[model samples]
Target chain A: MRFTSLSGLALGLALSSTAAFAGEIVLNSDQSDPAPKKAMEELIANFQAANPGITVKWNNFDHEGYKSAINNFLKANPPDVAAWYAGNRMAPQVKAGLFEDVTDVWEKNGLNDQLKSAAPSMTIDGKKWGVPYTYYQWGIYYRPDVFKANGVNVPKNWAELVAACAKLKAAGIAPFAIGSSQKWPTGGWFDYMDLRVNGYQFHMDLTGGKVAWTDPKVKAVFDKWAELVKPGYYIENAAALDWQDAIPQFASGKAAMYLMGNFAVAPMMKAGLKEDQLDFMQFPEITAGIPMAEDAPTDTFHIPSGAKNKDDAKKFLAFVASADAQTKLNATLGQLPVNSGSAKPDDKFLKAGFAMLSSAAGLAQFFDRDAPAEMASAGMDGFQEFMVHPDHQDAILARLEAVRAKAYK
Target chain B: MSAIAAQPDAPLAASWWKRNQLQLAPWLFLAPGIFAFAVYVMIPIVQSVSLSFYEWDGLTPDAKWVGFGNYTELWTDPDFWTSLRNNVAWLVMYLLAVPAGLAVALFLNQNVTGIRVYKSLFFFPFVISQVVVGLMFRWFYAPNFGLLSGVIKTLTGSNIAILADDRYATYGIIAAGLWPQIAYCMILYLTGLNNINSEQVEAARMDGARGWKLLWNIILPQLAPATFIAVVVTVIGALRSFDLVSIMTKGGPYGSTRVLSYYMYEKALSEYGFRMGYGAAIAVVLFLIMMVFITYFILQMLRQERDA
Candidate 1:
């Protein structure tokens, strides 16, 4: 018994000494999808190759499970680095002081200049809380073949879009294929309309709950939505289908256009649509002088406040921010690199997306990410309700205004 | 325990403890299970009750005391009322499972050829998980290409999206829930029917009791224990209807299918609101509802025990 006890004590000491000497960074990521998981693996391989002395232990979690798992782990036993979203999703963590400020890493590595587009989003109270590695642009993904068949030129303004929709309707095709059953697809529509009609500032204020849902500006945005909805531009019984379920309608030539993120390209291709057949376009100009803003939900990595290996964590963040690193990672991810100096993707769709996002006046992290979750849910519900029953717009707006008042307060 | 120590010098305390050992042994056997239940179940329930009186976002450590605030807010919340109404609908509609199960049991009780296989096949839905059951029902209720929609279109010349329509979504989900619940109730009655007092049934038939009269006067009273258990479990299942609703609609189509349990989950955990305090208040309300039934059940049992 004494010998066993003595050996246990010796083993514990040896383990402790090794732990104290060898630098280890624990990373928690929600990149369980095949493409992004491969990207993460390659990123860690390069990071380890660069820093031979440091070891990164990665804990991967499924997308839905990670949202709930994050709070428990961050408080009880936090990882050195964790993947999270930007904008209001990260705001709560920053406010709670759960995320470590990495402004110094950004300054020393010139990340502020390289990752310029995402810098404002990662900043909280003039300090950077995280390093964003990737983001994708949301736009109108349509069939060029369908446009040619209908004699519809790519819409350049609101009038052109309306005319194009009318032409498409005459040609026996709905203009948009949307599935608002899940409701986030409806959020994308609302985000774009608010961004186009009222510009980025109004979009931000409305999502931030600084503007009431009953505001006339908010009503005007809904009025534009009602025009398409009332005219039956979307698929019938759209609320019954999921986003993926709606993709089939667009791919089968039943629908002409889809307003979605760049990720839809893979599924669209898989559904037997050729790369040349499909095209990406910026949403048509709505208000002439407002410039253009887009939804670019950025994925980022941050050091938890309770992280043990701060130095190694900072090194990883710096590496993630580097243009070379981001370029390599985004190549595997099929997403745009957050770093501005990174090489533009060679894919035709991504090439178009990059150009559109690079020239955007601002980026609003999609409506759900910009607003608090409760308000976003209520707002999306209102949007869906408006879509199904546009006549009851006032009642829906009143309900939303009530929820916003309680949620924001 | 050890032959009562077998001597006078074994000490009086040992003898006394040993004398009372049979009485103590049953309690000693129950102690571990009782302790586990107290720790895991009772403690969390008490904690949740206390938590209802505070404002907690479920993440940060800084929880503010806000007595009765969450409850008062829930009183005016439309979502809360929607969930409550759906829960009532579920309770009323789910009772249909009991009578439906009885009908199926009666049909399948005969000793026909290959009856065992048919019975097993009918029991298949109950054997599978609720998640799979929900998915199967989702495909069945899918709007455009679903089997049910295809049938509706063929007959009525118009397809009805039951899961999408606000008026029918709850009923659609409840109907899915009934598939498995009816199978469960049928199995219970099947077992009860197997061990029935045959002599009493035979005597009742001889005394001019036939068909419906035979079933009402004879068989049902004998299956009282089975019926009681089925009602208890069905009531509990109705109240805790979360999985099917979650997998089917997620309280969507304007939150029309929201039930108390699903609403509580949304409030506490979902992307919508992590209002843990408010969720706990909702849970306390559900617990009170369950407690009403539980106390009634226990009181009934006690009264029966006295009569017996």
Candidate 2:
């Protein structure tokens, strides 16, 4: 009875607030972690200080809940600005006209030049829909001390990587630390392999379901992955562990490397590894002529079409796009700022990540973000299966092809 | 009441409301609860049945009439077959909880100094949320550091990651689910034993019945209601086995662990992007399968009611 009354009171308050907008800008974000939450609060503070007349209201949600909640929130009582992803992750929202076109804001703020690298990801139908704040590069985070102790060179090619894994195994260390229980960690391996083996366009096409999973190019990606999987280079029972659970293997020196996004650095450091103990390297070259395309999943802010405070939302977006804002935000996030003019973070991994991402021929959003959710789910499942049973390559690809056909339709 | 009773004895026409009040009062008392159930539960089931015949992503304004198209698609979808097979496996294996619970209840039914503590300790798993149970089992079956893996390694000279292996993943989860379910059934049986007719058992013993014979001839017949409830709950629990699979494997190792509930959720809500109509179709199929057992159980319940 008490719970019902309390919820009723909450509903009443929410309805009243939505009914009457008091020139306040409401921002909903999925930066519920301590660090990212703090960064968001600081960004709001800076934004409010810059525009004193504007009052900002921020509602933060946990990462997982936000994904399921966003659609409902957007359709119902959408905030003025909300945090979302880039690439195909954002494309559906753009198509439904649920996200506001922020091209004018981009043009007015000179973001075309400032956030040029992020333009292609943010644009839909030749118009920008959102401004990307931060993205982090994916690469191999390895224990240099272990590599040195094992007499393993930093692998630069497919053969070298294979040889390094063999040497690591010989030295009684696991070559890779992975946890596929969540199924997405396996997607990372597939993404990097596909990006290298077939380059960005073919990889993107495959994820988008434009290219069949049974195609030779797709098969080549799996064949390369099998080289590592068949050798038992990865830690055992990866499918039973989360990404965080796999970190102990690398931190305890049982495993030498982890191919992960830059977000993993802080966790690795927190696990008691010193800065000098660990280093980042690009996923090594596979196909000689194929250009290097990096996985740099981006986080961005956008205006919902149903927003009451359009002017303030535009102001917030413009303020967030500034070099000052992106620099402050990404510094706290420990990620690479999307703006070219933003001051680079001084951390070694961040410096390396920024360089790797900037030097890449193209940026493919990570597998889950790049593909439609249905295909991503099926693809990740196949990837995890392949990791466990690489010999089932043909059957897995055939299954994936069926899912792709259905999802695209 | 004194004034009304005195006045009601004076004229039949004036006392009609009082005469009918007993008959009307019960329905009046039940009206609110019945109305709530109809609105919240019955309406949604009807809505879902209708939704199964359409193609609509949850977010969309328009729903396209698909008329059994989703079911036709499911006919060819291998995941549907996998989920159905897993459901059958869950139902068959999960029934082990009944016998297992009976054994535990029999063991703990003795009057001892620390018997209450032992009973509570055995019942602890049911009190823990299934999410916690799932996590605990995930840790237990985790490859390197898990307790079970440690035992396996000691015995076999190699570690086995049960949840990671497609062949054993569903069974591992079902085992975890059974730990708590058995506890639940044991508590029910313990209560049933406490209420058993002591005189009948003594008479059975006097007639030379002993052990299993005593239990079968005397105690078991008296515990029919408890057994019925336990079987019903266990069957329901087995059919609705989603949380464990979701937490442990997420229907992974190539979607080998998916059951109807998890598949329906994945189709409608998760990163698969909302295929609400497709999800509804899956739910309808699950509901139909459940109806078979539900109908049989209800018929047996009706027979028992008639006899009573």
Candidate 3:
């Protein structure tokens, strides 16, 4: 009797939610982490308060499952508002007409200027696909004390970086700590390398498949990476470890530096590094006279084209794009807000990231976001092979070139 | 007379169910099962084969038919060949588990004290989930602090991450798979041993055929059915080696450890793989490869059934 009653109540509730009224907007996002979830709840409550008549229904997904879930849900039962990343990751959705155009919202609400840094990534054919709210900077996170002990200054260019790595190697420490098992961590490294070596436009073009992987400029970037890889500067057996597993090496003084996003700062701190010991530096420049470009992969919200409540979804997107909401949301997220009008973050690591990003010549959504999924997948695997065997450069590049030919089409 | 119920045999017509109840009742009982099979298994396979001839992103309704396009692409795809090569390697290496299992089972067949405890302890790996076995073995082969690497380091002052090295990764996963598979084969042989005719064994023992001679001539022939079962299960398990590969390596180190099933998933369902038509093509190939072995197994079973 109890089971039937309970199931009846559940069934009723489910039906009620499905049969939404005119005032309701169904939102779907992946904010499953504790802090993000709290922030999302607060954001929704605030939105509801501001627009009293509009009631927002939110559905949250765990990070990994949400990737595939978005594809299915958007095609079948699209929520009014959906969370997604910027750049080529969104390109497929836009091309398939699964995502609704929000250019008018951006123009009318003045988001084009407030979210200026993320506009290029959001735009395809001069129209915006999503509203970006939060992003984080990726650079070299290093142990300052280890650099001091080895008598190495923070490297500013390729030569100095190589010399610094040599000093660290001689001091019986791995110069770099990386875990390539999941492959995204390697993507961060490759993005910084390609950006610094060939500069942003060429790097984007290469990932976008306009420039061939067999091109000499692409080879030059690998040759630059080889300087560190060939010398055994990276922690041994990195390919077997996940990104979190490699953190212990940095914390325990086994490795001296890590190239990762600002999200890594909290975990590194949790791993027992004092604030003074851990420091951030912009990735060292590879080519002379190239403008510095930093990677900042943005998380955005879009109105799925199949949405039933387009008007309400647009309102939600505008509210999220606003500076006030962004400042509070990013503080909870412990990351950088996409809105330039938002106040500077309180955390020291975020402050450094914010400052570096402000001066960057251009910002790139990382390799995975900049390149299509198939290309990113093949490219990152190729990157791991190159990292392990620098001597296999030609063959690896040739293989990637072959994939690039097919992937772009 | 109400037309005498329209016929002389009206009473017999009313009792028709009673006449054919045995056959009709069985069909009625099997209806649900047959419907489920048609909906779930047989229909999906036919759909998948047809789907392989199209080009679909799995996002849109537009699926352009391109006959032989995906298959032709697969012919040149290096990753496909790599997956096929690794699957062949898995089949050969996995078969070694049968002999290993028989050896362990034979040794345990003797009358000993607390033998049930021994048997249960040996059977433990088979009972544990494949996911747990994969995890345990992954850690066992992990670098820097893992058991095998730690031992290797202490002895040679060099540590090797087996799963990180493409050449050794598949072997490492296979070793892990064998741990449980061997236990399964051992259980099957144990049950076979319990049912073997005791009179023949006793007669052979009395004839002074006390060693390998008696085991080979008498015991082995009786264990033929058990061996047959073990081979069949092992072959299916080998081909269905997706879970261990997924758990242990995820077809990584640049996909060097990918077998057919993992590769099929990588091409079809993975984050980068929404090319449904391409994925379907890979699936069809895997199904065809499986059919070759499945056909042989079925023929062998039919022959055995007829002989009996």
Candidate 4:
């Protein structure tokens, strides 16, 4: 017995020393934003400087590709830390027990207090699963010159916006430049229309599968959206193009407005459109008394369950949640920082977006991110079909209802 | 008889190893290839088939078996029907490549200076990735800016966004798909042309046969093998056309461009969540449809084998 006890003690010491000599942590992310990439590289450099023993090998992928690749990677060789979306989007992995619960870290690092509003989405049941790095608000991006040329002002209400679209159409300009070529872009339109028509609570309920898609309010929203499609007020080639591809039309003053997120600024700049030329506004109000809620989807980081370097991964997540990292990331990427003290951009549109987001009573994640991917996909397809043939509202609602039934089950 | 009996003393029985050598040798030679095929091809197909009968979000532990429910739902699903119809249309239209390819092959079969370069240039599309082809077609169909649209606008005084309009979206995609497929068929026929009987062509020429009549009577019969293979591959390509449609339109312009393969993917893996069972049902239907061609091909091959 005495000999066995000593042997166990010797083995434990050996294991501890071996763990202490562990190599670099692999950090996989889906952030392809140039500014964010540079800021993250700088942060990684700082992390390496602070911890001489530990290193980080970071890799990035496009958002859609990253989701599939990460799922595949986790099945075999999961990274130490990886970026993921929050809300119902993370529910599958969390339920699978693939993610490591960071509840203790949340309390210990005081991130729970710092991110009180965002914590609910990150927490599954009672444990925090991820740390949000940055988020952005979604709205309508319009070309001011086109609006001015058509003698149209930024409409604060639905009727005025419709009238403005008519004026633009009369002046031989596309009222909106939307690309249904990518299904997700069309989903943004559906979400905005739904939010304006039915209010935030109903939209949430509908996505959460607590309400049927055939509900009267949902039909009403689709009806209103159908009216926009009736006169072909949108760009003629909206069907077979990507959102980025549609930016040139807005930049060249061929079309006036684009319904998109703040990330659209990069593409607008790429098209040689100046900040003053491009501006934004909240989606026009549909319901008289309903409050405006911004679509603010956040990008977050999490540690997988079988991470190689748990301590190092935790340290990285905490660092990303820090004000310094948020400020740097926002400054570079034009993203709204999750951290309360992060600096705001000087651009008027960004400042307006920031003001609108900060003062808003409620915030919703983008439709696709907030809802389960299944519901969002089917819902978006229904929206596209409705847009193409507004007369098929009944048929579209029925199909969506069928999908929701299957999805919820 | 006595001499033969006496030989038993010389060797009563052969060794066990010697008796089984023929059987064992063949197994030993086949072991590596069989093991690899089982691991990669056979296993995944079986797994996908098994996954189709259950409703699991890929990550969940509990998978509910829905049996034929997925199939039943798919039958009534408009998107599924539309995709199925589109795939049929694709198959029928894609068959045009076999004849078109033969025509090109006949035209370019002769030896001429720089003719080889022209042939290779014609074959270029087949070597490029479908993603690149889709992107190229997208640019070519980009309304006013696109080359094809520009030419059409000049000729007809009207612009056409081939990819955008529902009436022409599927055909536009099919036309793009045909570009590479025709090239593939052309190469196959060119190789077939090399193997044709020179004596028969000489005899036909002596008999005053030329042009369409001469080619139809003599040349086509010789190229049967190449045509068979071309038809088989083209049919398969048309049926499995998900990549181009996905990259170009994503079954958009209101899902008008959706084919069975893309529809299956959308059902199983897209943001629409993993309706594995439903996707499997779609797969099973697609498999059944492909099986018709497969069965006919197998029968024809068997008949040829017997004849040979």
* Docking model 1 quality class: medium
Ranking by TM-score: 1, 3, 4, 2
Model 1 DockQ vs. reference = 0.51
Q: Write the per-residue lDDT of candidate 2 for residues A205-268, one digit (tens) a residue.
A: 8887889899998888888899999989999878878899999999999999999988888889
Deviation from native of the Cα of residue B15 in model 2, angstroms: 9.3
DockQ-superior candidate, 1 or 3: 3
User: What is candidate 1's TM-score for chain A?
Assistant: 0.90
- Per-residue error for B219 in candidate 2, Å, reads 1.3
Position A377, candidate 2: lDDT: 83
TM per candidate: 0.93, 0.92, 0.92, 0.92
Off by over 4 Å in 1: A1-24, A53-55, B1-10, B13-27
True contacts kept of each: 0.58, 0.69, 0.71, 0.65
**Each candidate's interface RMSD:** 1.8, 1.8, 1.3, 2.2
Model 4 chain B: lowest-lDDT 10 consecutive positions: B8-17
Question: Which candidate, 3 or 4, has the higher DockQ?
Answer: 3
Off by over 4 Å in 3: A1-27, A32-38, A48-60, A306-312, B1-5, B9-29, B110-113
Model 4: per-residue Cα lDDT over B1-308, one tens digit each = 99999787556465456778898999999999999999997887787778778777666668898776777787788888899999999999999999988888888988899999999998999999989999999899888699999999999999888887778989999999999999999999999999999999999999999988888999889888898899999999999998889877878777889999998887777655466777877887888799898899889888978998
